[model samples]
Target chain A: MSSSELLQFLISGLQSGAIYALVGLGFTLVYASTGIINFAQGEFFMLGGVLAVAGVRIGLPLPLAIVAAVVISAGVGVAMERIALRPRRDSGALVLIIITIGVSMVLKSVARHAFGPNEMALPAFTPGPPVLLLGAAIDRQVLWIWGLTLVAVIGLTLLYTRTRLGRAMRATSLSHDAARLMGIDTAGVVMISFGLAAALGALGGAAVAPLTQTAFDAGARAGLKGFAAAILGGLGNPIAAVLGGLVLGVLESLSVAFISSTYKDAISLVLLLAVLFLRPQGLLGKSGREKV
Target chain B: MKTRRSVLATVLVALLMAAALSGCSGKGNGGSKAGEGGDAPYRIGAIVSLTGSYAGLGTPEQKAIEMEMKRINDAGGINGRQVEVIFEDDATDPAKAQAAVARLLEQENVIAVIGATGTSQTMALRDDIDRAGVPQVSMAGGSVITAEFDKNVFQTPWPNRIVVPFTLRALKDRGLVDVAVISDTGGYGKDGHDLILKGATVAGVKIVADETFNPGDTDMTAQLTKIKSASPDVVLLWNAGKEAAIVAKNIKQLGMAVPLVGSPGNGRREFIEGAGDAADGFRFAAGKILVPEAYGEGTPAFQVAKKFIADYSFAYGVAPDIFAGHAFDAFLVVTDALRRIEGEATPASLRDAIEATDGLVGVGGTFAYSAEDHNGLTEEELVFYRIEGSTWVLDK
Candidate 1:
């Protein structure tokens, strides 16, 4: 590839990587607090897109529609935690996984019924000509994706480090019983983490909706990729999840550019499996001592 | 009292035995003759994707089939036997499709089957239908299903192989020689891409680039960028549904002004709506068009399509898709064949009648099939159309 072409590829990769990172963060946040791999993370993403479209259909402005999507998705995440996850709190991990899978299916089916089986495209965020970068051109929506992803990352980092709720959430993640004994509302922490994760997923969906076009079924693939990225970066580690998302996105872009486009998804799966086989703790994940 | 109860039980047992025997013997011709002046209901099965990725394609086809059945039944039924269509949801999975066909064969006891929408799904059940000696008509445009003549299996729509050549001819006529072909890595896409390549070679068109993506991929920027770099005069998209739409939008987003061309998937309303103004100037072969002037004003096909569009819009509040038209056509053809069979409603007889269909008008153009050719329509039946103002307008 030419230098300009390479730059174009990198820009496109980073744009997609940002979306992946946000989704990965959602996965990491929920897993960290609940010790459950919320398989419905992708559904939250899809819900965001569908809800935004619904808002637009109701004559809401684009920005308002995005906010509505985020609010609705966050509410849904809290409801899911209360109804589905809380009921099965004492259940095994396998049961929790199945429940989330069921939730994903229910969410997908509801979306299908409401949105119809056809794919839907949101009105473009910008009406101007596409911005050319190096030798390649990309739409302004991609820029929005990059901007939103960075903002989400910084916002989440600040929340986790500088806020009282963030410290409580960290405490809950470390030891739920201990946090509860120390006067932290552990249930509230779980709900808050799920809501925040869902909001991030929703933002990711809204940011990419103009580019990818929203479909009821888009979540399954996105969810799988986000989960794979989370696992690759060390499940529960926010920083690692973001890094992994970028790496996977860039690898996929490179594969499509150089190898074969057909094997792009397969390459991610292979990479995830390879990482697990080689380093069970993930790239940046530290191996923890087993509980007595 | 014991004797009274035993006698009542014996009588009930006798009646139950008689019912069971009659039900078993109902499979025979003699048994059918005894049923209310030979007015037996003939069952036709449909294995359609009522849910899943292909639901948009399958749902309309199902509706069309039902509408055709209603039309046929209104016309004094098909050869005096009421047409009964049993619907099964395949969910667009091949394994489910196989089981669905078996269920239709064993449980529903349908004389013939009308659907199996995707190529993989249809191919999965082709052997079972062939062995069962039942006629199976597919709306899927895969050529491999009918490449070798199967008297039992028929396709109402022209296969992609035939349609692809016509598409190339139209593009070549328009002086689009340098082409980029993008397909999905599946049977449908591979078949379509292969045909496009063959047609391009025949038409002396240079393939500037060839690319493929898996199903469910939302991003095509990389592929589109590469294709743009090659600077092809036209881009040939050979994927179905969402993938095709994504490619179209991405190509436009990349600011590549090449005209996009392809077969029917790109011709659908979904693609036009998904790609919006970017889909303008996109051309593809429409398997059928509701041109009242060409098909004649009062023809059954045209009349039905007009009513279908109105009713579909009234019912679903959206225009009926082309798949609905194809499904409607397939249903009409099957009903016509059933009427031809008249008294002999066996699976074998129905297959023979369907194979002998000639000059049958359907929503998807005229179908004329023989034992040698399972695909009823030809390339001549396909009309080229371009998206104009979000509607498919005939390309002059």
Candidate 2:
């Protein structure tokens, strides 16, 4: 293939990679704090996009609509933890994971009813023609996705290292009993992690909605891809998850470009299997860490 | 305090369960057998996608069927029996459609089946229908429904076998010879993809680049990027889902200058609304419902279409799409055949009568079924339209 064609494929891959990274990061945060995979992470993403569209339709300004969507999604995350998970906190991980699957279904049904089962779109944050980079056209909404994802990563890094609540969360992820004995409100830290993860997912949804168009059923595929990315990155490491997402996206794009479009989705499955067999701890994961 | 909270939670759960039970019971309408010394209603089963991707097509189809049912029953019944249609929501899945047809045949005892809105769902219902010996008038447009003809299966909409060559001829007439096709891996798209490949040779068009994506895929840039490099004259989209809008937007995002053409599947309000500005200038070949003037003024077909459009618009506050027209014709085909049967309307007789339909005036066109042909519509019933400013303008 020509270099320009290769560049075009890379651009497309990076745009999708940015979204997978944001969603993967959400998976990592919740897995770290709660030890339960949140299958509903994608539904939060759907809620953000569709609710933002609804907000815009009901006369909210674009910025205000996006902010309202993210805030409401965070509230939903906290409410899910309080109402569904908290009462059954003593239940084992398997039961909790199944509950999360149920939550995802409920959220999808509710969104379908509320949004009327049609695809919805948000206007790009900056409306302009695509910028041409050496024969590749990059959509303006893609730039927004990349910028927001970078901001989320930097913000998450600072929170994990510099804040007291973040330290408490880390301690709880390490050992819930020991953190409680140390006088940390581990339960509250779990709730905060859920909120933060939801907000991040919603932000990704809002950023990509202009490009992909959001529907109630959009969550199932996104959730599956994001989960694959998390597992490919060893499931618990946030930074590694981001890198894993980019790699997966590029691999999928290149497969379509070089091999065939028929095998595009198979790339994720193949990568997950390869990672499991070859590098079980992921590319950047430490070898001695617990397998999440 | 803990006990009081638990009690409140129990009460809430009880209320929720009660509401859900009520909703389930209310879904099936007019299936009563207690008829107060009169004949029971003529039961017909309709399998539609009331809640999934094809919901846009099926919702209007359901509305059209329900409206016609109410009208037919209000006019002192057909042959002294009320017409009642039992509806099942397939949710746009093929397996659900198969299960629904089984229930309709074994439990509901419907005389005929009207639909399962999408192509794959319609195809999925064939086995149960043939086993039950009931007539099925499908609302989907896939060619296989008739090309792989079942004696009991008839279709209302024009199939892809007819529409594909018409579209290829349109492209050739405009001197846009090189074609790039991006079809979905679903039944309808697969059907169109095969036809386009075969028909391109006869229409003197070259296949420059052909790519496909699976259903529910959100991005088409990778496929479109490859298509762009080949530099085709036009892009023909062959999918009915709302994802077609994504293809339109992706084409624009990549700055591809070629015009985009589509199959009959792209002729929907959702395609226009979902694609927004990207939908403008899009072209497709479909029936005359979008611009009913193509039916020719003062003809019988024109009068029927005009009346249905007026009544449907008055009832729903929006114009009926081609799917609604297809539903109208399906109901018309069945009812007209019922009126023609000289003896008792049994399943075998209904199936034969539907196959023998002739020169019926309906919204789609004048349908005439025969032993050799089931999809009775012709190219004369179709017209081309170019979208402009969110509405279709007839393109001569």
Candidate 3:
């Protein structure tokens, strides 16, 4: 392949990687704060796309539709935490996982029934010719995806590092009982974390809807990949999850371009398993120390 | 207090007994109603993907069958007994399809079965369907369904052999020779791909590039890029659903801008929406078109399709896809046959009538069947159309 062609392929890979990173970050955030893996994270993504399309179909402007999608998905996240997760707060991990899976199935079924079993697309937001950089054509959608993902990541970093709420969240993640003693409402933090994660996932979904049309069952694969990225990145580390997602996306793209397109997804899964087997702490994860 | 409790318990027991007896009587009446005309209505069962990815294809099929059933009943109740159809959801899974077929055969006692929308699911349940001496008419385009040609099994859609040759000829007529084929790793895709390859060879077209993708794949940039590098005259896609559209979009994104051809599955609206302007130049074979203009003026088939589309859209609030046409044709064929064998509506009699169907016209072009050829349509029934501004326009 020509260098220009390679550049085009890489650009596409990076754009896709950005979306996966945002979703992976959401997975990491939820897992970091609570030990549960929220499988319904992908459903939140689907909600974003379906809601935006419905809003646009009903005469809302594109920007307003996107905002509505994000808000609605975040609200769903909070409701899921309250109605599904909280009800089984003291239940075993297996039960919690099943409940989340059930919630995902319910959301998927509702979307299928309401939207009908057809793929839908949101109207494009940007009105212009695509920009070309080094022979790689970049559309306005790709620009939005990369920009929003970076902004969300930086904003999340600030929220988690420099704020009082961030410290409280960290404390609660470290020890809920101790954080409660320190006057933190641990339950509120959990709700906030789920909402924020869902918002990020929603943003990713809305941004990629133009590229990958929204279908009722679109979330399952994307959610599973995002979960894989999180686990590969040591389950709860934000920076590691982002890195892992980017790496996985690029690897998948390159595999399709060079190795074998049919086995692209398999490459991600294989890498994830290898990482867990060899370096479970991940590249950027801190090793846990034994308590004396 | 003890005396009052005993009296209340006795009254509750008596009411329960009465309710149970009434429920039994209602069921008994329903059974008798089913057998009111001396013999039970000829029960035909359908296992369609009423839910999940295939629902878009299956739901309309169910509607068409119901509409045909009503029409048959209105026309003297099909030789003194109404045509009854029991439908179940397969969920597009093989195991579910097996269970569904078993339930329809054993519990519903349906004489003949119609549909199991997907190829793999249909194939998985074919042996059992044949074993039960129940005839099946699969709507999917898997040629293997008829390879062994059980007298009990039939196909409604154009087999891959017929569609592939028709597609090749269409491309060849357009002066396209070298082609790239992108197939999904599924029975339908593999079967279609092999047939296309054979047809291309017969047409003396070079196979420049051949690639495969899995179902549920979103990106096709790499495959498209590689195919573009090979610089084929046409890109032929033999997959269904989102992948076909994604490939179209990615082909545009990479600036390949070549003429694209697809299997019948690409005729759905989703392909146009997903590919947007990129799908404009795309061509594919379809059993029927929604627009009357595509069929030109004053053809009998065109008139019927126009009326069906108008009535279907009025009821469903959306234009019907080609599957809807095939389904309408399938329903009409079965109902017409049922009318023929109305007096003796046994499984064997119904199968004989269906197999003997000839010169029948419905939504899908003219369907002619015989004992040897269970599939009612031929390559001549398939029409080629190009995507033009979100609708399929006939390719003259």
lDDT of 1 by residue, B1-396 (tens): 343234224423432343232111101111122133367777888888766667778877877777767766887787766877888777777877898888888766778888887888888998789778888988888888899567788887678878888888888898999989999977788889888777778877888899998877777888777787798999988876677877877777777878988678655676776777788888888665534334457877677567767866776677777787768777877888877875667898888888889988766777788868888677767788878888777786
Error of 2 at B181 (Å): 1.0
Task: Write model 2 residue lDDT over A1-292, tens digit each, in one string.
Answer: 7788899899888777878888988888987787777878888888889989899999999999999999999999999998888888888565676677778778887887778766777788898888899988898888888888888878877887889987887888877899999999989999999998889888888888888788887776677677667767755677777887888888888888988887788876686678767875567766664433
Clashing pairs in 3: none
TM-score of each: 0.91, 0.93, 0.91
Which stretches of candidate 3 lie above 4 Å from their native place? A289-292, B1-39, B293-297
Error of 3 at A53 (Å): 0.2
lDDT of 2 by residue, B119-220 (tens): 899999999999999999999999999999899988999899989999999999999999999999988999999999999999999999999998877778
Error (Å) of candidate 1 at residue B251 is 1.3
Docking class of 1: incorrect
What DockQ would you assign to candidate 2? 0.27
- Model 1 scores a TM of 0.91
lDDT, each prediction: 0.77, 0.83, 0.76
Return whichever of 1 and 2 wins on lDDT: 2
Top candidate on lDDT is: 2
Quote the lDDT for B274 in model 1: 71
